[model samples]
Target: MKKQYIFAVVVICLTLTAFLLTDSSDTIVKYPTGYRNWTHVKTLVLEKGHPLYEAFGGIHHIYANKIALEAYKSNKKFKDGSVIVFDLLEAVNSDNAIAEGSRKVVGVMEKDSKKFKDTGGWGFEGFNGDTKERIVKNMYGECFSCHLSQKNNDYVFSQYRK
Candidate 1:
């Protein structure tokens, strides 16, 4: 009788474990319909003499990546994540325009551009493109407020501009 009782207890434990793992309430993905367009985008390289030259005067190719995570405003789905790209350029030293150096850093970062303004659109957690886990959730601020310290040149290091 003891053996039978122990067996029954084991069965109950296994069943409970399975039910907990399969629970959908913990990982429910929620988002509004017709909100996928906010996530698709392409990189851009501003050329000289362009209307946006002042903003991207010496900017060259802009490298960026995309990921999906839970949305902050409306959507709470991991189907969307924030995409971040760094703009690399040959910047002129602030003291002298004739001096040149490479500035391979982020000038601007767009998170969930497609779904950025969408209600229920997911927001990004982090973007570390160096590793296979380029995008992950539950990390980094939705917006990088630390860059506010660089407000001298519109939040971008203008020292690199020619």
Candidate 2:
């Protein structure tokens, strides 16, 4: 009977170890401070019927002190300016590989006259070393749709349209 109990404990320990090892690789850490050459862009002016009127678009209403930080990295550059807007959410679960509610999304916008640009464009999905996988997807459908109309105005639709 004692041998059987020992065997079960060993098996459980091994299984847990395997799960922990496999889950760690999926975690990623992100921070806004990593971006270099930071600057403050003009606060956005949101008009009715704007495509970004949905929840994921974030809170609307225009004021100079809306608190958006913009910047370009040293090594990376574009003809106009590779604009990036980022927001850091409060961390939730710090210990687990899969943290719930600890993450951020960074939007990258590049100016283009001919092509429809990302108005609040491509998002860089980030997570802080958790089992939840960090994903960065191109928001071509959501962000690009609005910028297409702003072709005459440098493909940005918000108040800070280039």
* lDDT of each candidate versus the true structure: 0.39, 0.40
Writing each residue's lDDT as its tens digit, candidate 2 over 1-162 gives 999999999999999998997783333223334343455443432234767433233322221111231312222223333434433222343465422243234444533322323333322333323233444344455455655686554344444434
Rate residue 99 of model 1 by lDDT: 36
How well does each candidate superpose onto the true structure, as a TM-score? 0.28, 0.35
* Candidate with the greatest lDDT versus the true structure: 2
TM-score of 1: 0.28
> Model 2 off-target regions past 4 Å?
1-37, 44-53, 57-81, 86-104, 111-138, 159-162
Per candidate, the number of residue pairs that clash is 11, 5
For residues 1-162, write the lDDT of model 1, one tens digit per residue. 999999999999999999998795434222222322334233344546789576445544333233321222223322334432343455564664433246433333443434433322323232232222323333224333444454443232222111
Cα displacement (angstroms), candidate 2, residue 132, comes to 12
- Per TM-score, the best of the predicted structures is 2
Q: What is the lDDT of residue 83 in candidate 2?
A: 37
CA shift of 89, model 2, Å: 6.2
